[model samples]
Target: MLSLFLFQISLNRMIKTLSATNYSIEIGPLTESSFQDLLTNKYAHSRKVIMVDENTHDNCLEFLLTAFDDLTDAEVILLPAGEENKVMEVCFQVWNALSDYGIGRNDLVINLGGGVVTDMGGFIAAVFKRGVDFVNIPTSLLGMVDASIGGKTGIDLGAFKNQLGVFKDPVAIFIDPSFLHSLPENEVWNGFAEILKHSLIADSSLWAKIKNYRNIDDLYTADLIEAGISIKLKTLLNDPFEKGERKLLNFGHTIGHAIEGCMLETDSPVSHGHAVAIGLLLESQLSNNRGILSNEEFKEIEETIKALYSPIELDEEQIAIVLELMKNDKKNSEGKIKGILIHSIGHCTFDEVFEEEEIRKIL
Candidate 1:
């Protein structure tokens, strides 16, 4: 009887492992068998290429290889890790790698790292042969919830972040939360920033859940990925092409992207989430100033973000540069600056453009 009980427990563990591969986020939980299923069923006969960075290669290459075991032939591409590395130069590197791999239109590429890997790889796949299918196997929290789920793929152009990219959804995305255990503390914090943003935009319940997240360990659990992905998917399903109300996803991204550009101009670039953390606070203040967001709600946002990240002071000069970046933001229409602002939890709207002078004072 005891032997039978042990066998049942082992079978259940295997079943749990198999169940993780169907996730939409990047770093949820994936197993070797699930990957095989994707390759054999959904993407059979599709040439495969996996893109990664140095750190991700060191950390996850072995597991990735096991996932691709059935593939007799595959290609691997590597890039430098960090926000600074997500650029045209790296894009060119991927282009070259794809060329060498002979990746064709029918082929599929797998991005196997954090946001940088997935974002750049997805962009290459989108443009390669005028577009091909791609998949995401994100290894970081930020990549899982934000970058991997949305069809928003691109590389940073010059000092501008995400200035060059496209919105091409992948054939499939698999998240394995096991990867989060390997992430650095700061990287984990970076991902939490996006999770918090999701909650603020459309799911007050999720915001409340994240508010109580005590540390990195809390985010690695399956519950965080499940809740975060559900919120993001709901938003994208409503705005797949980002043509309308979906702009709510930019809650903190408006100023965050600009701040990212500012830091990129300097030698040190901020993580996407770190920059967005500052953006969230500043934008919350903007919402309050506009009288849409209540001061108390703004205070809640400020306290929540500050609980996890330290404030980065931006001087007048820095603010000027960020404004320039915002002027070129993709959401801007024919040179008019537009922003997505929040009025309350689960409430957001776009089409309000902030004046350069006005933003300067806010800075």
Candidate 2:
């Protein structure tokens, strides 16, 4: 009976491989047996470094250490938690640490935290010794579904988000849903917004399934997570560098990132998902005004987002400041503000230039 049950557990695990231009993303369980296999077969002789944030260091690091006996000698690097610490100074600290420890190009880095840790650690690995191999073990829903798969790695420039970065794919991505068990409710919701964005841009069926869920908890299944990952992987397969369809994935990020940046300056910091939820509503309004998205669809999208997130009251002054930040967005070209606007659910258009006066009116 025990052998049969263990076999059933193995059969139930969902594994998917997404191939990028240069590398692949493997999503599945990170069990002790599986991790031990990875260590013994892949990195038996290579030096290992594991990067974690304060939160993950406290909560999730033990699970990783106990997964494989080979990891006993791996160096541990702890970073300060949160988006505020994702800066060049942190990268400098990481680089300096790698240098002091003599982490060579053949060494491996295992990023074992949320988006902030993965982003910073991946950047450090990409630059140190002219690029070392790294693996991502995402602990947050946001990182697991969005940040971990994409090859884009970077740090913020001042108040700007992801202003400096590179395209460096991880050697492997091990997504163990067990990590999500330790995440706060807000952190879960923070990643759900990206899933929502993926549905809105590509899968009407996913959008329908998501709209019926009364709360965030209902969306935590492995199938739902894989659906979100599939949409992003398909987009990346077509345009890895955001030259066309890939930009569709940025549907709510333009205005959302601006709001997030502004909020970071205030005492009340907003999560990435919260700001994107607001951006979805505002951008949907623009779509409706442009006659691209119907009023009925717009109402449904607005009400659904409003139910999930509270309205953020932004005055004219705040709107003006956000607009200034949007102008600095990397998506812009030839001094024109580019946006991704929806035509309908699961249908979006990217690189749409909007006049300043027109945008101000929508805000």
10 residues in a row with least lDDT, candidate 2:
1-10
Best by TM-score: 2
Per-residue lDDT of model 2, residues 1-363, tens digit only: 000100012434455554444454555667722455667877778899999999999999998898677889999999999889999998899899989998998888999999999999999999888899998889998888899876889888877999988988887778777788889987888788898899999998899888756676675676777778778877776577777888888899888998888778778878888889888888888899989999999998988888788777778888898899999988999999898999999999999986677777877
Q: Kindly report which residue stretches of model 1 are placed more than 4 angstroms away from their true locations once superposed.
A: 1-28, 41-44
List candidate 2 stretches off by more than 4 Å. Answer: 1-22, 32-34
Query: What clash pairs does model 2 have?
Result: none
Candidate 1: the clashing residue pairs are 26-144, 28-175, 28-176, 28-177, 29-175, 29-176, 29-177, 30-176
The per-model lDDT (C-alpha) reads 0.77, 0.83
Identify the candidate with maximal lDDT: 2
Residue 10, model 1, lDDT: 24
